[model samples]
Target: MAHASSTHDPNVYFVPHSSKWPFFGSIALFVMMIGVASWLNEASWGKPVFFVGVALTLAVLFMWFGDVIRESVRGNYNRQVDVSFRMGMVWFIFSEVMFFAAFFGALFYARQFALPWLAGEGDGAATHSLLWQGFSSGWPNNGPAAVGGAFQTIPAWGLPLLNTLILLTSGSTVTAAHHALKAGHRKQLLLWLGITVLLGCVFLFFQAEEYIHAYRELNLTLGSGIYGSTFFMLTGFHGLHVTLGTIMLAIIWLRCLKGHFDRDNHFAFEAVAWYWHFVDVVWLALFLFVYVL
Candidate 1:
């Protein structure tokens, strides 16, 4: 235990010994992926298998992160390691940016280009001749032969609008929490951060309600066609991000309660805060492109 807590000289990098967490984590992810593939194929046992995998994955993450938190609090990390962590986080966020950009690009292409190619447009006299006829190009296109069937779009002025404000407000609260941390105000930090996490929960709850309404009432679904597919893909992925961010923020809040961070040494908080802000930004873009626009 003393060896694990060794901080080393400032100029020397701290090297960690062998651990089984990575191996276990890899196994958990492999199981999860297998379950996902099975579920996608509609296998009878897939749902149960997938849930077991999810449980395993979550358990591995909990243990792995617990080890990291223990190491960090034990003063095993140094300035150079900190710099490396920061760089890794920056690149991780960059990759996330590109990931969302691809989905947004798909949405853009579907609206601008694919819509035009699918038969013809009725915007003016007619932009192009119909390849299939009867299928008019428009914003909420189903498919070439209206194969996706009729579906209704969720109004931008309702749950989506409220969610937008909620995320924006969560962003501000997280920022306030960061400020409080920097100022060494633990109470203020916890208050604002707790609010931010609650706001995240509220956003997710409302989104789930909106989804229920869309599926049960509006008949909107993944199979609803181009509009439906793009809409669900974008929003679903963003919701997943929000869930992960909320979990991280909650973990950081726990660390705060344990007095694990000081004014100048709260990289975990900063990293989670960075992720939350990124989530907020992505939601804004998603609200605009997927909802309002």
Candidate 2:
């Protein structure tokens, strides 16, 4: 019953009467979380439940985004609606910023405060002497016990540098695509967007190869103490973001081919571009702090 309106009124805001996607999405998330917890604990049924939840969640998102696309194509959005969408995306990216900030904060705390305290620095001398005794405070210290045994860290100049270049190149290509779209050069837009998508895929592939090398050769793992934990946590999450961004770019490419947007009314393209740029900036920070420094 809650379908997009075919008729448009420039003076009024369009509002959907109701939607079921949110409720379904919530249920899917709940199931997924439970499954993840159970799977981590090695429960037998957890794998199936997790995959099922993931499938359902993806289905819900597809349907939900399809609805929005239909609405946009129908001219249901106005100038005010565009402004609202832009503000919403701005807040969404802000929230993602905070999300990464928390992890970086944890990394800083571990390196600057926690490790030193454990090694008997300042007032922690008594505590460290009493508890950890011979524990040496090091940047990549695996605690006094050597949590996951000895491990080698990946060199920053290798795959990480390559991935950084890939992302930077992708950012430029996406910008070119944006310019092409605005200039009404559909062929150029498609070519640039396709290149951006390919770059994203290459970045992801190299990241996966890096992970394999880390695990098999370097023995660097999530359980390899705070250093390893922080390493994987930061890079892993960033990879996930890249994957999502790539998918979005692909979807936008398809939409562009379908002539869904024009020069003046292409907020959807702008929104995804904004997100991709944000992703590029985040990777730059990650490279400087997590990999280089």
Candidate 3:
């Protein structure tokens, strides 16, 4: 219940005293992990436990962010704090880039090396002889053992393409909103940000439909060999990022309505914009590598 101290000097960097949110968040995450493990093993109580953990985690985030927003609005943040925030966001985005890079690397290695080796191409003759015989080495191979049975891939020209366009348009809308904010046009800013949020929701809807088609019609699933696994892993995580970005945009929209940001002091808006743009770029990569090529 302690509030940020109001007696701090403006020239110095402000730091809040120890907060319990991090500890609570960590505990929630641990509980969620336990629930996930239990659910995977078909424990009867896992679903409820997982839901409880998720609710607890979200509550913690809500309270924690509310505190931060209160602090920002109270002018507790200065130039040094702003610089630190910028640096933190930059490094966070960099880490996210590396995370996706790892996934892409796995895809590349599986396609260029693992699949070909399993099929006895080049120097893999001995490996093939000792292991999977008569296995085909093709793009989208179901592995030598046929781990998840045969399945058809969703075409690049279908819902995936539509979602791509939606994300691109949303990117434009968000950029326009940023420009509007900078120009002190609150009406235009709200309009464009709302459009961006709508586009994000549309993209997510299409993605869900595409997932349904993959599962029911195409027989594609998480267990559908390397192709299916990698496809879902990349797209699913990206979808989750889009969901988070959209939520952030929505929150910003509400803040804008309350006259929370001024022309020159809106790093919160900029940070969310940066994140949304990053999500767009990652989706572009996913479209090219996972769907097109």
Candidate 4:
């Protein structure tokens, strides 16, 4: 199983195509949006139709990815394809950074500008002091700006700490797996890769449990106020990224089992590993700022 490398292989090159993937993707997105609109409007069948579109979109994604993987395994991917993949990953990660940045910006504005102004911290003191008397800037307030609810903040001691450790450990294991693959230690690579994947899954399980506890036990939700909003936005996106990274690792594991990648040329495996590690880093930042601070 020869992995794709930088070397140009003319036999494995594909001509540019006018493809239907764009149309299929657009249709799926449109249907999903319609479903969202319908659901919001209380349409009886909106949810079902939206779910159908979701299924269709997923199928399209599966077919698209399957084609790419098949082409790679069949040696139809040349250096050009590899470069395209690298560039695509770079841009994909950039877009994700921007997405997270928006949420962070919201958090910043809420903490600095909105919260303070509401607390009479600035020149708007006259306006703020008149409207929301006795209100102070803080993270979690279950009450209104005047008499906010007294909800307890989630502690960063137990579950979040454990999860942080789990993600860091998984990152290390993934690094070890990459090293093993490069060294031609197939057995070692499999063992470490399997462990890393299991860690990712376990992290997800614990995160879901945490969310359940927050909602049911502590009454913490997206509507809980600024605290809930920022908490959910940051952690929710991080969780989604973790889920995607886990899926990527699972695919890499399957390919490994099938002996699809050689030690000398496993760019796909490396790329996914890079992405997984990047996700881990982002989670670390989230854990520190969102949970601890």
TM-score of each: 0.92, 0.95, 0.94, 0.89
For model 2, how does the per-residue alpha-carbon lDDT over 85-126 read when each residue is reduced to its tens digit? 889999999999999999999999998898898899988899
- In the range 71-132, model 3's lDDT, one tens digit per residue, is 88887887778888889999999999999999999999999999998889988999899988
The true-versus-predicted C-alpha distance at residue 282 of model 3, in Å, is 0.6
**How far is each candidate from the true structure, as Cα RMSD in Å?**
3.4, 2.6, 2.9, 2.9
Q: In lDDT terms, how accurate is model 3?
A: 0.89
Sort by lDDT, top down from the best: 3, 2, 1, 4
Best by lDDT: 3
Q: In candidate 1, what are the lDDT values of residues 34-75, reduced to their tens digit?
A: 887898788988878888888998998898888878788788
Pitting candidate 1 against candidate 4, the one with the higher TM-score is: 1
Candidate 3 error regions (>4 Å): 1-10, 40-44
Q: Write model 4 residue lDDT over 233-287, tens digit each, in one string.
A: 8998799789888988888898888888887767788888878888888888787
Query: Model 1 TM-score?
Result: 0.92
- Top model number, TM-score: 2
Flag regions of model 2 displaced more than 4 Å. Answer: 1-9
Cα-based lDDT at residue 285, candidate 3:
97
Clash count in backbone of candidate 1: 0
